[model samples]
Target: MTSTADIGLGTAELTKIFTTATRIKVCDEKFRSLILTGQVSAQYYSPRGQEIVSASMGAALRESDYMVTTYRGLHDQLAKGVPLRELWAEFFGRATGTCKGKGGPMHITHPASGLMVTTGIVGSGLPIANGLALASQLQGTDRVTVVNFGDGATNIGAFHEACNLAALWKLPVVFLCHNNRYAEHTSFEDGTSVDRVADRAAAYKMRGVRVDGNDPVAMHTAAREAVARARAGEGPTLLEAMTFRFFGHQMSDQNEYMKPGELESERANDPVLRFRAALIEQRVLTEPEIEAIEAQAKSDVKDAFEFAEASPLPELSELLTDVYEEV
Candidate 1:
C-alpha cells in the first residue's frame, strides 16, 4: 500500500498535477465565458469543479495508455496534452479542430495522445474501453485502457456487461466513475442503488476503491494502483471518484434543480483551487509560484481562443470531404 506521504510523488510531479488541474479549470472557465457571449454557439458539458480527477488520472497514464470519456471531457483532453489551439478551433467549428470541426466538443478523438474514444452516449464508453483493452491483450501488449463515466451512466446495461467481460477475460482496463453527485441534474441517491459506485466492482470479482477525487494525493494513489494492476494483467478495477460539479449539466443549464446551498457549500472544495492552496500549505510551492502557474494557464487559454477566432471556417466543399458513404 502506498503511504500517505505524498503518494511517492516528488515536488515536481505534485506540481504537475496541480498545474494540470488549474489548466483544465481555466480552459473550461474561458469556454463558459465564450458560451455566454454567444461567440461559441455549441453544446458543451463543463467539467468545472471536477478537474482534479481527470488531472490525477491523466497524470498517471502513459502516452501509450488509452482513455474513453464522455461529452464533458475537456478536462480529460487538456490534461492528456491535447493542443489547446486545435481543441478551441474544434469548439468554434473551424477547419483546424481535432476532428476538422466535425466532432465538436462531444466527439473529440485524438489517438496520437492515446485518447482513443470520446463517446457521447452515457455508459457506452465502458464496453468500448473493454474492446480496446481486448485488442491490446491479443496483441500481447500491456497498454491499459481507462474508461471514464458519470454516476448516472452506471445504471445503463453496457456498464455492467463490460465490467463482467473485462473481469472474465482479465482485460487491462480501469473503470473510473467520476461520481459528481448529480448525473445531469439527478442526484446519485435518486439514480443509484448502492452507496458508492466502487462497491459494484465486487460483483465482477474485481477490486473496488473509493476516494476524494478532489484531493491530489488520494486520487493519485488510487489511480496508480489501479493502473498498475491492469498493466500486470490482474483484471479491472473500479475507482469511484467522489466530486461535485460547480456548474450546471451544461453551460446553458439553469441548474434550478440543485439543492439549496449545495453549490455554495462545494465552493470551499473546488479541486482546482484546493490543490493550489494545498501545495502552498504543504510548503511544496509558494503562493507566488502558484499564481504564476495560474496566470500561464489563463494566458494559454486566451491565446487558443484568439487563434480559434482568427482561424478560417471550414470550406463549403468540406461538407462531403470527410464523409465516406452516401446516406
Candidate 2:
C-alpha cells in the first residue's frame, strides 16, 4: 500500500480531518451495539478506519453540489453536514427522517441537503450519479455530482456503464471508489487481476488517481481538483482511495476470513490516530483541543441516539399511503 506522505494535502488540515475522527468511531461502536442488541436486523458495514475518504470528500463539496452515496453512507451524510438528529431519526425509521422513514438504514435521501438518494444495490448509485451529471451538463449548470462506492462496486456492470457514459459525454462527475481491500470477505486479490482500481481509469481515457484513503487532507485536495476539472468541463475524474475496513463486511459475518493480526495492525495505522499524532507533531493543535472535538462528537451522537430511541416509528396508515400519490 502507498503511504500518504506523497499526497498533496497539508499536514495540518489532514490532522483536522483525521483527528476529528471520533464521530466515525462512535458510529461504529453504536452500530455494533445496535447489532448485538438486535435493534437493527439489516447487515452493517462499518468503515471504522476508512473515515477519512468519505468525511473529507463530504467536506470538499459545496452546498449546491449533489451526492449519491452507497449502503455504507452514514459517514458521507454526516460529513456533508447532515444533522445528527435527522440522521438518527432516519436510521430509526421515524417520520422526521430525511426520507420520512421510507428509506431506512440502507436507503437515505436528503435532496434539500444535496444527498440525492442512497441505494441498497451496491453499484446502482453510479448510473444515477451519471444521470445527475448529465442533467447538469445538458442544462449547462456548473454543479458537480459526486458518487461514492466500494472496491467491490468497481467490478459491477453498473459501475462500468456509468463511467463509460460519463466519460463519453464529458459529464461533471467524480467517481470516488473506496478500495478497502475486501468485498465482503473476498479480498481484492481473490476478486480481480488489477493491482489498483485507479489503473482502470486509463481504459476510459479519463483522469485516474490512487490516493491514500486514510489521509483526509489528501482526499480533500484530490476531490477539490476533480470537482474543479469537472466544473471546467474538462470531463469526469476517477479517484480510487486505498483504505481498509476495520470491521467485518457486515454485522453477521464471522470475519474468519480476516488474516490474523490485521485488526491490530490497522489500529496502529488508524487514520484518526495518525492524523492526531501529525497535528501534535506539527504543533498545530494541543491534546486538549483534540479531546474537546472528540467529547463534542460523542455528546452529539449520544443525543442523537436518545432522540432516535424516543422517536416513534411510522404509522401503518402513512406507510400504505406514501407508496403512491393519490393525485
Candidate 3:
C-alpha cells in the first residue's frame, strides 16, 4: 500500500489541475451564455463545481484508453484533448464539430481520439463501456474503458444491469459516478435510500471506493490505482466521486429548491480556487503564473466561440449519412 506521505503530487502538476478546473468553470459559463442567447439549441447542464473529477481522471488516462461520458460531460471531453473550438462548433451545430454538427452538445464523440461516444440518456453509456471493455479483452489489448455518469444515473435500472454484467464478465471497466448531491431538483436521499452509490458495488461483488471528488490529488491517486488494476487483469471497479454541481441541472432551471446559504457554502470550497491556494502555499506556483494561465485559457475559449459562430451548419444531404454503414 502506498503511504499517504509518499503520494507523488508535485507543485507543478497540482497547479495544472487547478487551472484546468478553472478552464472548465469558464467553459460552463460560456456554454450557458450561448444557450441563453439562442446560439445553441440544447439545455446546458454545467458541471460547475465537479470539474476536478473529470480533469483528474482524464489526466490519469493513457492516450489509448477509452472514455464514455454523460450529457453533462464537457469537462471529460476537454480533459481527453478534444479541441475547444471543435466542441464549441458542435454546440453551435456547425460542420467542424466532432460529430460534423449532427451530434450537437450532448452527443459528442471522437472514436479516433479514444472517446467512444457521449450519450444524452442517463445510465445508457454504462453497458456501452462494458462492450468496449469486452472488445479490448478479446483483442488482447490493455485498453481500459471508463464510464462517467451522475447521481441520477445511479438510481436507474440500467445502472444495476450494467454493473452486474461488467462484474460477471470481469471486464476491464471503471464505473465513475459523480454524486453531485442532486438529480435535477430532487435530492439524492429523496431519489434513493442509498447513502453512497459505491455501496451498490457489493451487489456485483466488485471493488468499490469513494473519494472526495473536489480534491484533484485524491481523484488522481484513485484513478491511477483503479486504471492500473484494470490493465493488470483485474476486473471492474466502482468509484463514486462525492461532488456538488454549483449550477442548476439545466439552463431553464430556476434552482429555487436550493436552500439559503447552501450554494454559498458550496462555492466556498470551489475546487479551482482551493487547489490554486494549496499550490501557492506549497510553493508549486506563483500568483503571476496562475494569472498567466487563466489569461491564455480565456483567450482560447473566446477564439472557440468565434470559430463556432463563423462555422457553417451541416449540409442538407449529410443528414441521412453516418446513421448506418453503406452496404
Candidate 4:
C-alpha cells in the first residue's frame, strides 16, 4: 500500500475516497437486490469492481469540472456528487429524477454536478467530452473535462478521432479507460492488439499512464496529475486504470467466458474491502469510523430507495415534451 502522504493525499481526501467507494458498493448491492426481487427492472450494468477507479478519479476534479461517462457509470455519477436520491429516482424511472424519468439509468444527466452525460453508446462520450473541453477553453476557464469508458471503447474509431483532435488542439481533457480486462464477454487479450491501452497514447502524441485502479493512493495520484496537467493547458492524457469486475458484464451474465478461478481471485481481492482494510491499517480511519461510514451509506441508500418508490412516474404528456424545442 502506498502511503497516502507520499501521494499528497491527506486523511480527509482518503476518507472521501473510501466513503464514496463504500456508497457505490452499497448502492450496487442494493440495486442488484432490488432487481433480483423484482422491485425494479431495468438494463443494469454493475460497476462493482470499478468503484475505486471512479472514486479516486472523481476526487481529483473540482465540482465545476465536467465529466462524461458510459452507461456503466453509476460509480462515476455518484463520485461526481450526484445526490443519492436523485440517482435512485432516475434509476427507478420516477418523475423527480435528474432527467425527469425520461432517461432512466443509462442516460442520467446532472449539469449542476458537472456530470453532463451518461451515454449508452460505447466510445461516444469521448467526442462529447472534447466538445465540453473546447467550450471551457473558448470561455477562458480552467475547467477540465474527463471522459470515462471501458477498454473496449478504445477499439472504436471515435476513440482515435477524439484523441487526435484533443491532442492537436491541446484540449483540456482526460481520456480515462477503466480496463477491467474484459470487453463484455471477450477477454482483453483476445480483443485488443496492444499489450497496454496506455501505449496507444503515443500514436496521438499524448501522455499516457497505466496504474492499479484498485489502489486508491496510486489511482488518485495518477488522476490528480492528469487533471492538473489538463488544467494547466497541457494536452490530453490517456490513463488506463487496470481493474476487474467481480460480477459478469451484466446482471444476467454468468461469466462463462472467464477462466475458472479468475472471478474468485478478483473477488477475494475486492478493491472495496482492500481499501477499507488499508484505511484501518494506515490509521487514516478507525474501525468505528469505517463502520460509521458504512452505516451512513446504508442509511442514505435506504432513503433513496424509499424516495424513488414513493415518487410518481412521468406523465403520459411527458412523452411529447422534451422531444424538441418549440422554436
Candidate 5:
C-alpha cells in the first residue's frame, strides 16, 4: 500500500474513507470469531488483506451508482453502505437480513442501496453490471456500475464476453478485479494465461490498469478514473487491483497449499494498519481519534450481533415466497 500524503485528498475525506475501511476490517475480524467459535453455521470469505480495495472504491462511488459482486462479497457489501444490523442479520440468517435470511452470505441483494445483486456464480457479475449500466444510460443518468470479482473469475468465459459487450456498447461500467493471486487455493499462474490480468483489457478495447489493491491511495485513484470514464460515456475500465488474503478461500480452508512464511509476510504489511499509520503521519488524524474509531467499530459490531440475535428467522410461510412466482 502507498502513503496517503501524496493522494491529494483532503484530511476530512481521507479520514472518513480510512475509518470505514477500518470498520469493515474489524467487522470481518469479528465474523471470523463467530465462525471459529461455532456461533454460526455458515461459510464466509474473509477480506482481511483486501479491505482497502473496496474501501477506496466505495468512497469513490455515489449512492445511485450500481454494484454487482460475487459470493465472496461481504467486504464489498459493507463498503457499499449496507447497514451493520442488516448485514449481521443476513449472516445470522434472520428475517431482517437483506434477502430475508435466505441469501445467507452469497446472494445478498439490496436495491435500495444500489447493490443490485450478489451472485454465487463467478464472472456472472460483469454482465449484470453491464445491464445496470445500460439502464442508467437509457434513462440518461450518468450513474456508473461497478462490478467486483476475484482473479479466478476473469478466466471464466462470461468475463471476456461482458467486457467485449461493454466496450462495444460503450456501457458505463467499471470492472474491479480483486486479484488476491489465489483462486480457491490455485495460484494465478496455474489458472490464468496472462502475466497481468489488466493486459487482457486490450482484447475488449477498454482502458485497463493495475494498482496495489492494498493501498488506499492507489486504489482510490484507479477507481476514480474508472468511474469518471464510465460516467462520461467513455465506456468501461478494467482495474486489476492486486493484493492477498490472509486466510484461505473459505473459513474451513486449512491453508495447506500456501508456502511457508507467505502468510506471515503478507500480514506484516497489513493494509488497514498501514492506512491508519499513514493517516497519523499525514496529521490527518491523531492516534487517539483512530483508537476511538476502533472502539466504536467494536461497539457497532456488538450492537449488530445483538440485533441479529433478536431478529426472527425465515418463516415457513416465506419459504415458498420470493421463490417461484405466480403471474
Candidate 6:
C-alpha cells in the first residue's frame, strides 16, 4: 500500500525509473531476437521479470559508485550505464567491446561506469566487492560498492566470509540478493534452510531489509537508504530484493520445473508493464510520452546491434596481448 508520496520520489525520479526499466526491457527483447534469429551464439540469461530491481537500484547510485554483478548480469550492466554499443559488440564478439570481445556477456567490465566486475562464478563477487570497499575506506573515499547476487549465492562460503569481514571492519558495501525464489532448477524451500535471506544478516550484526523488487519505489527507497548508509560510514547492509524471473535459468531452459500456471501468472504481472501503468496513472507521464521513450530505446538498441554486426572480431595477435603486463 505504498503511495507515490510515501515513496518519497518526485516526478522526475519516477520518470527516470520508468525510462531505465523500459531501456532494459527493450534491450532484453532485442537480445532474445538475436538469439532466435541465430545472429548470436552465446549463452544468454534473460532478466525478463526482474527489470525493476536493477533499474531502481541503478537509479539510486552515483556514477562513481562501484558494482559487482553475476554472470546473469545483462540487466545489471545496462542499468549501471554500460554503453549499449560496447555491450552489444561484446555480445557479438567484436573488438570494440569492453573486453575487446574477449569476455563476452558473462565478464563485462566497464570501469568508467564503475561496473568493475561481472563474474561468472557464484558468490565470488562478494569478496571482490569487499576488497574494493576496504580500499575506499583505507583511502578515505566515500565510495560505496554494491554486489549483486542471486538467492543461491547466499549458500556459498564466500557469502558468510564476506559478510562477516564487511561487518567486522564496517566496510562500505551493500549485499544485494536478487531472491527470485528458484536457485537454478531448485526452489528456495528446497535449497535454503531459512525462509528469508535478510534474516541471516543478524549473525554479522548488520542491518537487514527485505523489499518487493518489482516495485520501483520500494526498490529505489531500499537501495537509496543502503547506499546512503554505506557512504556515511554506517557500514554494510544486507538488502534482499524479492523478485521472480519470467524466463528459465538459461536460454535453452524450457521451464519444465515451474509449477502449473506459475510462469503465466508472473508474466501477467510483469513489472515493466506495471510500472508503466503506474507512472501514467500518477500523471508523471502520458501514454504518448511513454511510447516515445520506448521508441527511443528501440532505435538505440537497433543502432547498437548494427554497430556490433559491422565491428571486426579480435585480431589473432590479441591472444597474447592481454596475457601479461610489462613492469
The TM-score of candidate 2 is 0.92
Score every model by TM-score.
0.96, 0.92, 0.95, 0.99, 0.97, 0.98
Q: What does candidate 5's lDDT look like per residue over 1-327, in tens digits?
A: 455556687776677678788888888898899889988888788888988999889988998889999878877887888888998999888999988999888888998888889998888999899889999999999999999999999999999999999999999999999999999989899998899999999998999899988888888888899999999999899999999998899988977888898888999989889888888887878999999999999999999989999999999889978887789
Give the Å error, residue 129, model 5: 1.0
Q: Which stretches of candidate 4 lie over 4 Å from their true place?
A: none
Q: Which RMSD values do the candidates have, in order?
A: 2.1, 2.5, 2.2, 0.8, 1.1, 1.0
What does the lDDT come to for candidate 3?
0.85
Cα lDDT of model 1 by residue, 1-327, tens digit: 123353667787788888888899889888888789987788989898888899989889999999999998999988777889998998888899888888888988888888886888999999999999999999999999999999999999999999899999999999999999988878899988999998999999988899999888889878999999999999899999988888889876877888888888898766777677677777788999998999999999999999989988898889778668767
Question: On residues 112-135, what C-alpha lDDT tens digit does candidate 6 reach at each position?
Answer: 999999998999999999999999
Cα lDDT of model 3 by residue, 20-62, tens digit: 7778888888778777888667756788888899888887788
In the range 1-327, model 4's lDDT, one tens digit per residue, is 587767678999999999999999999999999998988899999999999999999999999999999889999999999999999999999999999999999999999999999999999999999999999999999999999999999999999999999999999999999999999889999999999999999999999999999999999999999999999998799999999988788899999999899999999989999999888888899999999999999999999999999999999988878878999
- Colliding pairs, model 4: none
lDDT of 6 at 46: 86
CA lDDT of each candidate? Answer: 0.88, 0.81, 0.85, 0.95, 0.89, 0.92
lDDT of 6 at 277: 87
**Which run of 10 residues does model 3 get worst, by summed lDDT?**
1-10
| Evaluation by TM-score, superior candidate among 1 and 5 | 5
Best by lDDT: 4
For candidate 2, the per-residue lDDT at 321 reads: 60
Instruction: Provide backbone clash counts, one per model.
Output: 0, 0, 0, 0, 0, 0
- List the candidates ranked by TM-score, beginning with the highest: 4, 6, 5, 1, 3, 2
Model 6 error, position 217 (Å): 0.4
Clashing pairs in 6: none
